[model samples]
Every structure is written in structure tokens, then in C-alpha cells.
Target chain A: AQSVAQPEDQVNVAEGNPLTVKCTYSVSGNPYLFWYVQYPNRGLQFLLKYITGDNLVKGSYGFEAEFNKSQTSFHLKKPSALVSDSALYFCAVRDLTSGNTPLVFGKGTRLSVIA
Target chain B: EAGVTQFPSHSVIEKGQTVTLRCDPISGHDNLYWYRRVMGKEIKFLLHFVKESKQDESGMPNNRFLAERTGGTYSTLKVQPAELEDSGVYFCASSNEWRTGELFFGEGSRLTVL
Candidate 1:
């Protein structure tokens, strides 16, 4: 079974400051990682995914994540934060063997970007 | 193109009452998935449907919950004798390609089992 763990329940960052939301995954084999964001009263929106490519994966809203194979981590990062960036973020993973399988998600981390 | 849409955006019912939620996937999307979020917890997968077939239902909580995707277009999930623990948001997502696995999601149906 593939699983994702996000240690932080909440993340706070000031405007113009960089922010990081941590996530670690455990999979039987190679994993397909994904990041999603959900705004208030809205559905989870696709941010980005890491299939098998460069360690740095960039996505919408100036967000990026570093995939560390050795550390078994894929931490979401943003060079600068905006008040509008405040939302709930989720990390998910699925084993490479089964692309059709459902993603195993981590407990979401609520991001609060302060102005 | 319209994204995934779920019916009964909010349903509040008493325990033991039956509630059925509906989801209509994006056109041409053959893969439909059901997931649930219990408050602040991670979203948990309930099942997956490939066309009209149940590809995987390993994550379904129990037999009390029944899901059917008839004719591979729209899916429905029926919960009988619901409990307080079942109060949460039920989300439906669809993906046209399995390899890419980028899913478009519905706003979700908020179910309250009182």
C-alpha cells in the first residue's frame, strides 16, 4: 500500500517570504506523487505531479516541490507567499505498478499566508 | 468542458435514514472515483469504477455503502443506516487517462448524519 504523511497540520508564512509544507511517502516500489490545493468551499484542484523526471517539479500559482528520492520526501515550496495563497494542501502518492489505482492521501495541511 | 458535478450539494438526514449521492463525470471520462473526507483528515478512497465495472473497492468502509455506475456515465452511492461518523464531504473525480492520472473533481456533497 502506498501512503503519504504530512507532518504539519498548519503552516504560516508572511507575504513575500518563502514557505515549505513537508510531506513523506512510503511505497512498495516507484511512486507517482501529486500535490493538490483546495480553497474554501471549493473542490480539490490539481497543482502538479511527479512521475519520473527532474527533482524540481513546478506547478500553478508559483508553487514547486522538490522530490528527494533518498529522503523519501516531496516538500511543497513557494519562493514567495501571498494572502490569496491561503488554502488547504494535500500530498498524495500511488505505486507506479498501478496507474489506475486510487491515490493514498496525507492529512491536509492548512496554509495561512499573512499579509 | 464541464467538470465533474455532484448532486445534493448538502444533505442532512437522521441516522438510519438512507441517502443517495449522485455524480456525473466529465464527458468521455471512463474512469470515475469516489473519495471521502472526514473533517480535517485525509481524503480516503472509497472505490473506483472503470466504465460500468467496479475496478477496485478495497477502500470502501463497509457493505452498508453501495456504489453503482450504470452504463458508465453517472455514478451513485447509497448509504443505509448512516452513523455520525459518516458525516463528511463525499467527492467524485474523473480522469480520461490513467497514465497521467490528472483528475477533475466535483465540489463534493456535504452529508450530515444527525
Candidate 2:
């Protein structure tokens, strides 16, 4: 089984400050990790994904995620946060070895960037 | 290009009623998928369609839910005699290729069963 865990229900960060939303995964085989953001009244927007290349993957809105294979973690980070960055973030994972399986998503974390 | 679209942005139905939800995938996209998120729960996959054919329906909760994609262009999910637990936000997504993990999602249909 492939699953993702987001420990924090909500994260608060100040504008222009760094922010992090932690994510961990459990998979039977190599994992394909993804991060998505859902804004109010909008569908989920793809942020980035980690398939097989560099551990540090940069995505939309100046966001980035670091995949740690040894720790089974892929934590999303942004060096400088903005008020518009506030939204619901979800971490998802799928087993690459499993043929065409659907993604398993986390419970999601609400991020609030205080201006 | 227009993104995936789902009809009836919001719907309120009485329990034991029948409801049909529709989804139109992005043009040129062959892979369409259905997922749902119940209150306080993570999003769960319901099924996957590849050009009007059911590739996978393992995630479907029960037989009360029926999905059909005719002409390989649009899809519909009908829930017969909906129960209270059937209330949730149903999301539809599409991808150009199966191997590509990136999926474009719709705004989703919010269903409330009383």
C-alpha cells in the first residue's frame, strides 16, 4: 500500500519568512511523490512531482520540495512566503512499481501566511 | 485550453434520491478519473476511464454507483438511492498520458444529502 502523512493540520508563517509543510510516505516500491495546492473556490493545482531525478524539485509559485529517500520524506518548502500563498496543501504518493495505480493523498494541511 | 469541467457545482438531494454527476475532460485527453472527498476525510479514488472504457473501478464504494463514458468524450457518475454517507465533493481529473503523474482537476461537485 502507498500512503502519505501530513502531520500538521494547520501551519502559520509570517510574510517574507520561510515556510515548511512536512510530508512522509510509505510505499512498497519506489515512490512517485506529488504536491498540490487548492485555493478557495478552485480545483487542486499541481505544484510539483518527484519521479526519479534530482532530490530537490522546484515547482510553481516559487515553491520547492526536497525528497529524502533515506527518511522517506518529501517536505515542501518556500524560502519566502507571501500572503497569496495561503491555501490548502496536500501531499500524495503512488507506487511506481505498481502499474497505473491511483494516487494516495494525505489529509491535507491548511497554510496561513500572515501579512 | 479549457481545463476539466464538472457539472452542477453544488447539489442538494434528499436521501434515497437518484443523482447524476457529469464530467467533461479536457480536449485531447484520453484518461479521465473520478475521486471523492468526504467530510474530514482524504480524497479517495473512485475509478479510472481510458477512452470510454473502464480501466479500473476498484475504488468504487458499492454497486449503487455507476459510471459511464460514452463516445470517449464525456463521463457520468450516477448514484441511485443516495444515502447520507454519499454526500461529499466529487472531483474529476484528466491526463494526457497514463504514465505521466500530472493530472488536471476540475472545480468539483459538492453534494449534500439530507
Candidate 3:
């Protein structure tokens, strides 16, 4: 089974400060990791994904994530936070070898950027 | 391009009643997926469809949950005798390329069973 764990239920950060939303995974085989964000009253929006490449992958809205194969972690990061960046973030993973198996998502982390 | 769209943005009903949710996938998209997010929980896969065929239905919870994509352009999920635990947000997604797995999602249909 492929699973993703996002330890923090909530993360608070000040505007202009760097922010990080942690995520870890467990999979029987290599995993495809992804990050998605949900704004108020909006659906889940794709942020970034890590398949197989340079550990660092950049995504939309100036967000990026580093894939650590050793620790089985793919943590989302941003250089600076903005008040509008506050939303619910979800980390998901799927076993690459599992064919069309669906993505397994974390419980999600709510981020609040205080201006 | 028009993204995936779901009908009945919100629905409130009594337990034991039936509810049907619909989704229209993007034009030219061959793959459509259904997912549900229970209150304060992770979004979970309910089923997947490739064209009009049921690609995978393993995630479907029970027999009461019925999904169909007759024309393959639009899909509908009908829950018979919906239970209180069935109340959740149902999200529909579509993708031409399921391999990369970057799915375009709909705003979701919020179901509330009292």
C-alpha cells in the first residue's frame, strides 16, 4: 500500500517568511509524489509532482518541493509566504509500479499566513 | 479549455434518500475519475473510468454506490439509500494522460445527509 503522511494539521507563518509543509511516504515500489492546494470554496489545484528527476522540482505559484529518496520524504517549500498563500495543502503518493492505481493523499495541512 | 465540471455544487438530504451526482470531463479527455473527501479527511478515490469502460472500481465502498459513464463524455454516480456517513464532497477529475497523473479537478459536489 502507498501512503502519505503530512505530520502537521496546521502551519502558521508570517508574510515574507519561508514556509515548509512536511510530507513523508511509504510505498512498496518507487513512488510518484505530488502536492496540491485547495483554496476556500475551490477544488484541489495541482502544485507539483516528483516522478524521477532532479530532487528539486518547481511548481506553479512560485512553490517548489524537494524529493528525498533516502528518507522517503518530499517536502513542499516556498522561499517567502504571502497572505493570499494561505490554504489547505495535501501531499499525495502513488506507487509507480502499481499501474493505474489511484493516488493516496494525506489528511491535509491547513496553512495560515499572517500578514 | 473547459475544466471538469460537477453538478449540484451543494446538496442536503435526509438519510435513506437517494442522490445522484454528475460530472462533465474536459473535451477530448478519455479518463475520468471520482473521488470523495469526508469532513476533515483526505480525499479518497471512489472509481476510475477510461472512456465508457470501467477501468477500476476497486475503491468503490459498497453496492449502493453505482457509477456510470454511458457516453464516456459525462459521468454520474448514484447512491441509493444514502447513509449519514455518505455525506461528503464528491470531486470529479479528468486527464488525457493518467500516467503522469496530473488530474484536472472540478469544484466538487458537497453532499449533506441528515
Scoring only the A-chain of each prediction against the true A-chain gives TM-scores of 0.96, 0.98, 0.98
Worst 10-residue stretch by lDDT in candidate 2 chain A?
A98-107
Interface RMSDs of the predictions, in order, are 1.2, 1.0, 0.8
Compose the digit string of candidate 1's lDDT tens values, residues A21-74. 999999988889999999998999999999997999999999999999999999
Clashing residue pairs in candidate 3 are none
CAPRI accuracy category, model 2: high
Screening candidate 1 with a backbone cut-off below 3 angstroms (N, C-alpha, C), the clashing residue pairs are none
DockQ for every model comes to 0.79, 0.81, 0.82
Best by DockQ: 3
Q: Which regions of candidate 2 deviate over 4 angstroms?
A: none
TM-scores for chain B, listed for all candidates: 0.98, 0.98, 0.98
What DockQ does candidate 2 score?
Answer: 0.81
Compose the digit string of candidate 3's lDDT tens values, residues A1-115. Answer: 8898999999999999999999999999889999999999998999999999899999999999999999999999999999999999999998989787888889899999999
True contacts kept of each: 0.78, 0.76, 0.71
Once all C-alphas are superposed, what RMSD does model 3 give against the true structure? 0.7
**For model 3, how does the per-residue alpha-carbon lDDT over B1-114 read when each residue is reduced to its tens digit?**
788899999999999999999999999999999999999898999999999999999989999999999888899999998999999999999999888869889999999999
Local accuracy by lDDT, each model: 0.93, 0.94, 0.94
Candidate 1 DockQ, CA atoms: 0.79
Q: B1-114 in candidate 1: lDDT tens per residue?
A: 898999999999999999999999999999999999999999999999999999999989998899999999999999997988899999999998755668888999999999
- Report the Cα lDDT for residue A11, model 3: 99
The list of candidate 3 runs beyond 4 A from truth reads none
